[model samples]
Target: MSHVSRSAAVPPDDLSGPLTLDDLENRADKAYARHMETYTAVTVLHRVHMDHAVWNDTASDTLGLAREMVTAYRDVTRKEWYEAYIAWATAAGFEIPADMVNDGTDIPTGAADDPPDHPVY
Candidate 1:
């Protein structure tokens, strides 16, 4: 596999404006999209590094972390990342209730082309 550096793909830390965790959370889809792009690049880089045995022939956390992150990326790729977030959060002991997010809103059947937006992403 070919590898590419992330310098060109990632936005500059100071690009457009100052960065904040909240800002990132607010742009979840955009952030996830960029993350997946850069992650693909970095994974290629790591595979190359492993091919060259740059890590001293010892297994490291990088591979596991990459797998976990990819799982997370797939979870967030859903149209309702925020809904999943709320569910996960509640299961994790947060106080968010489903009604607070879903609000009994009706979605037309067979509306795959227009999935409802996740309110809490």
Candidate 2:
């Protein structure tokens, strides 16, 4: 909700030194927050703007393209946020495990607490 960037949180000004676990956690938290904001905004646009555009039948091609782009953006946002969350959790604990599906990949939904295959809509 505050100022967040698309990149990691600001690190120590001296780059010569290695970052501490706390530092890494902070960075990951910022990354997660940044992506979370983006994902939330994209979802709102899809639900409100795209939904309206479709119902009105306004520029079907354009709306379809916009929907495609937003979906891609949402997917990326979800991934990045989850990665950051994992990193932060790992830093806080010893090792934070990912939620894996039977396919050997992540649950493809959200952070550790998300239900498997939760619908984005």
Query: Which candidate gets the maximum lDDT versus the true structure?
Result: 2
Off by over 4 Å in 1: 1-32, 35-42, 45-49, 54-59, 79-121
| Tens digit per residue, CA lDDT, model 1, 16-64 | 7643333433455554355445445445545655576455424456655
lDDT for each of the candidates?
0.44, 0.53
Q: Which candidate is the best by TM-score?
A: 2
Candidate 2's error at 104, in angstroms?
A: 4.2
Q: Residue by residue across 3-121, what tens digits does model 2's lDDT show?
A: 33324344443575655556666767776676555545545555665466336456566556766675676567666666656555544444444342224464355254333222365
Q: What RMSD does each model have against the real structure?
A: 16.9, 8.3
What local lDDT does model 1 show for residue 94? Answer: 51
